[model samples]
Target: MKTGEKVVLAYSGGLDTSVIIPWLKEKYDCEIIAVCIDVGQGEETHAIKKKAISSGASKVYVEDVVEEFVTDYIYPTLKAGAIYEGKYLLGTSFARPLMAKKLVEIAHQEGANVIAHGCTGKGNDQVRFEVSIKALDPSIKIIAPWRIWEIKSREEEITYALKKGIPISITKEKIYSVDKNIWHISHEGGNLENPWNEPKPELFDMVTPPEKAPDVAEYVSIEFEKGIPVKINGEELSPVELIKKANEIASIYGVGIADIVENRLVGMKSRGVYETPGGTLLYTAHKELESLVLDKETLRFKDIVAQKYADLVYNGLWFSQLKESLDAFVDETQKVVTGVVKLKLYKGNIIIAGLSSPYSLYNEELATFGEDKIYDQKDAEGFINLFGLPLKMRAYQMKHFVENQKYNKTTVGGEQ
Candidate 1:
């Protein structure tokens, strides 16, 4: 509430955050501490500090949290098999909480009482950022300029940035709001706003078009230890390296491109095209491994948990008790999920080649169609009868009621 107060801003070196730097300084007469927590934005992060300084930031912190992002955020979500709307892999959804946590840490270290983020009023990121911030440190105040600022549109924001002499990469003609991280890159806005319009070829960044992919299918083996991917094609890799390698391989095959029209947390439907080449590969391989290791009942229940977990992450409840509890259950289910899964990737198709796990529950003798089972075939008659008992009783009751109605109708007309 006071002028000249120190405020920590979540600076992405993007259009919104770049404009926010001078805007916050002009409005509050405060010192702006720009914090860009790097979760694999790649080359764009190289000049973030310099950009922040030029945009009137007193100090800048470009923290590299890629490893933490992969091991903590990405892996847990993957292990739970959480996918939003049965399609989205939740690339942008889970990243916001981690960014909020980093912002709070930087704010505490700098003795700042206020935090600012460039998340627009209409989007879900505003809720994700503010809710996580409140959950972590309720006392710190939040400043969301998109909701309060006089500028009404992206055009206005661009004009303001240009007038202030802030360097930016976005232009109106080529404006597509993009969010990029190690997990995926998402494209929204621009022509993508119209659901009827198909995304142009140039809209894709990470993935090759499926039609343009090679005719030959490529085989890759992914190994998992306790549901976490450890190796690809027999090479043991660090978490970051594994994802990067997966991205490299899968992108070539046009894998992991999702065009979704999903319900936003703020009660609106939005369309986005997501490029998650590596994430798709991991999710597919991990699921195949789970199918091998997990039992019928446990797998069914875990699927229910997966939907709820996806909701929690997508709705910005990453630090909540329910999410923690779900993680515990997922971890328990993943105990026997160590295995290797071979997949054939060809032009956006992930075909399961083979799967092997140390704790596999697939009994070959029982499941085999060629005779020689450890059970008798005649036992199925009793099992089927028991399973259909309720249906049989219901059918008998309906038949009796229909016969009684016919007799009553006949007796009403004449003596029986």
Candidate 2:
């Protein structure tokens, strides 16, 4: 609460962050440095900039980290096949850490000792932002307004914003907490909090309803080089462009609409709807390619690793040593994950048409039921005997034990 001290705030032109500019000034009596990282929100940054300054930010920084987000964070997660709780694709999970890291970098650059974010303490993002800041620069102080401020609800925050003369887009009636980026868009709050209520089709932004999707199926080919997506439909594209193209195509077929009521890291359960058209496509294609390239044992083991990796990401441990170690293992497995996967899309389904890789271990000739010179049918006898040896031994012992019990009972009865 020192006057003249500078605090860098992560400002997302939304109601919470827009109100934060005034809140920080009033609470700390410090100069506010509002920073907005462009992770492909598709909204006008110029408007966001003007709004921040008018709301009392001394300076505003709009950083474009879309490419970095896709290549460094999204691709790595996709390659790991990390789907949290078997449903959520972790759209908002990874975005938080990246944004928090940027906040730290900007704080250092601007010579600000304190960093502030608009994340609420009840949610996972608060942890994601704070933990990432701690990992990057432990000395930097974090000011989470939601944890300390008296504003309890969105309605209360709106009232505060109105009283402060701050410009905001949220209304009391149509308030839906949303987070958008290049990868996906997440919708929380509103009627989505109720698990029994199905997500109305109109609630979705990036995807159409499956009932409204095109009648005919669509096919697309995705190419991967060393686990990173490179091309779409035979044309090589940059990471950003590839995802953009995929998003465009998949959205048409109403792909990637997930409604999950997941357990939060803060020991609470929350429901949210995620629209990840491009991310779903990329994840599906990457998995298909890995299935072709990786051996059976390695693929199954990697699945186990994938679950742990999802946990680390969902819990906001991106900059930790364990994450780096897992990344090394994931990267090692992806060395041979080079190939193209063709998929057929109909409504909300992504069906694999074909998959091929130079390092593929699937030998069609050996796997066929017809005669094959490479695989000898006679060799199966020894293989089966060795494989079932323990089971066979146990069965033999049980049979002998039963026979001995019958013989002992007969001998005792005859003697009597």
- For 1-416, candidate 2 gives per-residue lDDT tens digits of 46889999999999999998888888778999999989899879899899999999999999999999998899999999999998889988999899998999989999989999999989999999899999999999888999899999999999999999988889998888999998899999988878898987778889988899999999999989999999999999989999899999999998998888898999999998999998898899998888888888999999999999999999999999999999999999999999999999999999999998888889999899898899888898999999999999999999999999999999999999
After aligning candidate 1 to the native by TM-score, how far in Å is the CA of 173 from where it should be? 0.3
**Which lDDT value does model 1 have at 224?**
98
RMSD of 2: 1.3
Number of clashing residue pairs, candidate 2: 0
- lDDT of candidates 1 onward, in order: 0.95, 0.92
* Best candidate (score: lDDT): 1
Identify the runs in model 2 with alpha carbons over 4 angstroms from their true place: 407-416
**What's the CA RMSD for each of the models?**
1.2, 1.3
Residue 26 accuracy (lDDT) in model 2: 81
Give lDDT tens digits, candidate 1, residues 145-250. Answer: 9999999988888999999999989998888999999999999999999999999999998999999999999999999999999999999999999999999999
Clashes of each: 0, 0
What TM-score does model 1 achieve against the real structure? 0.98
Residue 193, candidate 1: how far off, in angstroms?
Answer: 0.6
